[model samples]
Target: MTTADLHTLTGAYALHALPEDERREFERHLGDCEACTQEVRELSATAARLGLAVAETPPRELRERVLREITTVRQEPPAHGRRGRTVTTGRTGRWSGYALAACIAAAAAFGGVAVWQNQVAQDARQEANQATRQNEQLAQVLSAPDAKTTSGELTGGARGTVVVSQDRNQAVFLASGMERPPSGKVYQLWFNDEGTMRSAGLMNPAASDDAVLLDGPVDRATGMGITVEPAGGSAEPTSDPVALMDFPTA
Candidate 1:
């Protein structure tokens, strides 16, 4: 096969998915080819790095597992000829068993790192959520009606002004600017009726004036919110919401 074909086969070889004939051909070519060997080595190292990205705890008995596998791998005996006598004169080493142990140790170290990163990420997410809810509370306070219209903004024109009726049973989310979601998803408006958030309707996430207009004689609505949901609005939100406006009521 050409050099280009060999390069393309590197990934598949690391995954052990190459066909038997192709595998044999590549092995034959590799026996005398330095470039192919380098390519395969680089790809194997890259695969090893990716494997490190997923943190997993190795079994406590991993050494035993390695030993078992090594035992099962049959070594080819040297043919009884002049070459057999020469083989006995060659270097005798048992480092291969030790090399397998090193590979397992490397895998375990990577698994540990991945798990640590995941934990750090999860904590950061929780902190962000707490900050968001606090900001929502502040917005609710700032938007409360007092026989006069009130307004506020999030940084970078990212926040929208909220207007609530004096009686507070009805409101409208007049959003001037917002990011658009991809196809097969929509921004759904909702009302927190007596602590239960209820769907009002979905809006055009891309339109300049396609407001997430909400009108409800909705009972005990303490929270007004908007969520980017699936193509069809969900019965309940499963993802983090985009906008959650809090309204003041008597």
Candidate 2:
């Protein structure tokens, strides 16, 4: 499914309002789309805070219906499983709102506590999956051949560790232990490949020295450098490299 399709169904899925056909379809979409699943879970949490909400009277009987339906569909949180490994996505859902409304109106509803709880567990799982993916990505980028562990320093009144992965596919420069520019000055990263320079990003003197792993689209060249440039940085280096790191050929 397209990203737009997943976004369209996110609200329905999180609120547990999707019809049977839609639920099955979305599940298939989620299996392949990590980004969508994460988006849905975060939205679910926001919705949950309003579950026991008074901003609006729920449509009535939504809580019970959602519980009964999700009961058979969702698995309960494993009490014996790793602690905090799982979490309830959120308490508020499409059916949940409907159920809550009904409950408030003194209407009788199917009293299924077990099913209602399962939805909570599913939410927890969604959040766990997101965190796991980020951790894995961090490890992956760090393993790149160009990954460098430098004794952080600054030069020409500029400071930062230059990291250009072995393949020149990823890079990151974190700065610390340096003085700020004399107003209107900034630090920039540029990737020089085949005599062409592309601006990577700007530097903030306050940036920490942590091993900040940056996202991709880095220089395809074997060489990398940091320069003192404009606030937003330029495509080409206006000055010499205060710091330089290179990626080796595989």
Candidate 3:
């Protein structure tokens, strides 16, 4: 085989998918070709990482499908060597067919695992970016020289604090020792602008200690409040205030 053709087979060889005759020929080439040897090693390591990334259960019919294909397929005779004689398979042909089938199944499974791992990594990256944005928003509020903090107790034995920026255009709310809301209900935050109440955001009830960056136009709000509302929250206060704290305008 030409060196180029042998080079193309490096991946198949690394995956153990090459036929025995071709495998032996490739091994001979490996002895004198340092580049091919390094290529094969790197490909083999990549395949190993693909396999270990995720545990996959092969399809139940994989073996049956392989055996079925083998029954209908014909094997090619080995290439003639320098002595001009074809290599004889003898009784090993049957085992070699099964080995080829297993290799194919393994390769397919690894391909699926690599895709799954890629998606998992992408999701983790998105979550990290979201966290970074939240932190940046909170830092803006905390570092402002005109920042003010106020604390209050809620109806359900929960306590919370609100940190408002100088311009009151941004704020952060932190809650602790809060009980999980009853089913079909959620904790909702509101900004009291004059006598009008506007929705800020919803809170996760299960968290014992939670922090959220409040949506803005907060400078217009004279105070902030929390209430238990329906799952999706309400446009206006659906229940009396569970907690209320005034924002220092001065």
Question: In candidate 1, what are the lDDT values of residues 127-195, reduced to their tens digit?
Answer: 334433433332342344441233445323655655555444445454544554555566677887766
Model 2 ranges with Cα > 4 A deviation: 1-139, 143-153, 156-168, 208-216, 248-250
Task: Provide the TM-score for each candidate, comma-separated.
Answer: 0.36, 0.37, 0.52
Rank ordering of all candidates by lDDT, starting from the highest = 3, 2, 1
| Model 2 lDDT tens row, 60-167 | 597446444542343232222225443322323223345555654543346555565566567544534443343344445555545664434456453455545555
Q: Flag clash pairs in model 3.
A: 168-219
Candidate 1 wrongly placed segments (more than 4 Å)? 1-156, 166-168
Write the number of the candidate with greater lDDT, choosing between 2 and 3.
3
28-78: candidate 3 lDDT, tens digit per residue: 566556566566655555543442233344586984575344323333332
lDDT, residue 10, model 2? 60
Displacement of the residue 135 alpha carbon in candidate 1, Å: 31
Output the lDDT of residue 212, model 3.
60
Q: After superposition, how far is residue 27 of candidate 1 from its true place, in Å?
A: 54
- Candidate 1 global CA lDDT score: 0.48
Top candidate (lDDT): 3
Predicted structure 2: lDDT:
0.49
lDDT of each: 0.48, 0.49, 0.60
* Best model per TM-score: 3
lDDT of 3: 0.60
